[model samples]
Target: MRPPGGFPIVCHCLLLETPRGLCLVDTGFGIGEAAFGALPGYYRPLIRPVLSDAEAAHAQVTALGYDPRDVRDIVVTHLDADHAGGLRDFPWARVHLHAREHAAATRPATSADKGRYRAKQWAHGVDWMTYDDRGGETLFGLSAIRPLCGLPDLALVPLAGHSRGHSGVAVDTGSGWLLHAGDAYWFHGEVASPPHCPRTLALTQRMIATDHRERLENLARLRELPAEVRVFSAHDPRELDLAVS
Candidate 1:
């Protein structure tokens, strides 16, 4: 969703320092044009991502005085081109995601799925760790898959709607919990007491959503989350600014 004054649409990815190793919540546009290579022609004009090699997760990890290889696991919110683009940068990392998402992206039963999910991102044949909605605990009234592949502090909260199996990655930051609400909502005001979203942004969300009704339902649930649990979306720059501050 385009913001007023032509503000850039940011792709916020979370890099966590875990006991096992470094874990990435989602990988924004990968090195160079690797992420855009498989995308359709029309995508360029619509999204207009600012491509920069320095901003790639690999480069950022290296800049932080850590080897890129240390990132052993990647938990993705969905298989969308922008989200999963950096998987190739950390080919050895075990990619964790929802089973339904795996099917939709890999198999691609529908036209929308075909357009959104790009195969080149995972062309290296990643070590995939997929989960489902069956038997799991709940977090703030939302179904959650905890102890993600034995990582106690991390959990996957199923918040499908944007994609067939989109989810929010919940990180227990010791001080508190932070939920990376990936594309669940674009604007910061979406989770406000009386949730508000721009008409254009709302239209974009609806146009992109696989199930608009389910998206709204999950969004309502997000609004009810306790104040203690910090929640932020993938594309909201204000949230990102607050996070960095």
Candidate 2:
């Protein structure tokens, strides 16, 4: 399938306004260009991060008329450099991730693992809150963890495949739930019943997937979710446009 034009691959992040404080779903390319350029030669060109100083996650928070310091919690789908890059911006915020992801990131045992995680992103020290898939309502054949920690109306749905502890962050936004399926699938078509995808995107998914079979299974399940659930992945520009529009 040929991809629709004018939709560049976006490193989208979600900033939520909660009663406790401002909560962020994922931090997109939070680091400076210098730091990103300093990445290892082998992986630097592969990622080719388009980081802008003005576009840092914290700066965007300030632009949105919210104080960066007020952000108290950050719920992540995984710890990939692009997703977790902004962590250092709000050091005071407690970072949440799946326990398995925390382990994989902290102690990378394989070459692929080492390539994806950048140590500099979290070097500022984060108050890490690791969650196990223990409790929550089952939504569409998936574990929907409601009120993770003190986060009301927020749920952590474990859809581990791309990474050991990768998950989707589900938020109840009064009207309905928004499921941020981080890196679960690259293209919107992946979750479509027929599962159509651009050849390049399909290749990239295969290259980065930690478990190809599991990823496919998760995508199939996402397609089965009710329409009101409002599901979208981290990287798909079409999905991002629909959510924000």
Candidate 3:
């Protein structure tokens, strides 16, 4: 489906300079994937990614003057190909994600799950540390799995709907909490009081959603979050611009 005119989507990832080592929240597409077309065939023609090696997370980490090996932990909101494609690039990093997400990607009980996840992205056998919502603290009335893999002030807030076991990574950035709402919503307006998403983008989200009703419910809850808690979507360029600026 064609996107709206002049409305660009982006793959936004967060790089954290933590006490232990560099921590990455959502690794975008990998350099090798871009060069060798590791992504599914339908993705290229539909998404039309820029496919720049420099845009890859590994390259960006290197450009920032840090050794790629220093990236010790990776927190993924989900195991979608675009989100986890950089796993091989940082082979040594411990990957942390929801247990259900890992199972969905690796086992793929449903056809949709099979299509949504790419095995080659994680075929190298990563050191995965999975968490469930059973035992965790609460954040703003939402259940959160905290201290992901022993990293302090980091939590995974379950916000499944776009995909089974999809979640938002919550980071305590010293100043306040910033929630990276991965694929939970596509546009900033989605969490507005009177939520408004572009028709094309809204349709796209609905088409890919594992549970459209639940997704909308989560979006509603996000809108009710306190103003101090910053929330942003994964693919909205406007949100990315606001974040960087």
Please write out the lDDT profile of model 3 over residues 163-196, one tens digit for every residue.
9999999999999999999999988999987889
lDDT of 3 at 47: 77
Q: Which predicted model would earn the best lDDT?
A: 3
> Between which residue pairs do clashes occur in model 2?
none
Question: Which runs in model 1 stand beyond 4 Å of their true positions?
Answer: 1-7, 34-36
lDDT of 2 at 102: 93
lDDT of each: 0.87, 0.81, 0.88
- Per-model TM values vs. the true structure: 0.95, 0.91, 0.96
Model 2 misplaced regions, further than 4 Å: 1-7, 36-40
> Which candidate number would show the highest TM-score if scored against the true structure?
3
Error of 1 at 242 (Å): 0.8
The number of clashing residue pairs in each candidate reads 0, 0, 0
**Candidate 3's TM-score:** 0.96
Better candidate by lDDT, 1 or 3: 3
Which is better, 1 or 2, measured by lDDT?
A: 1
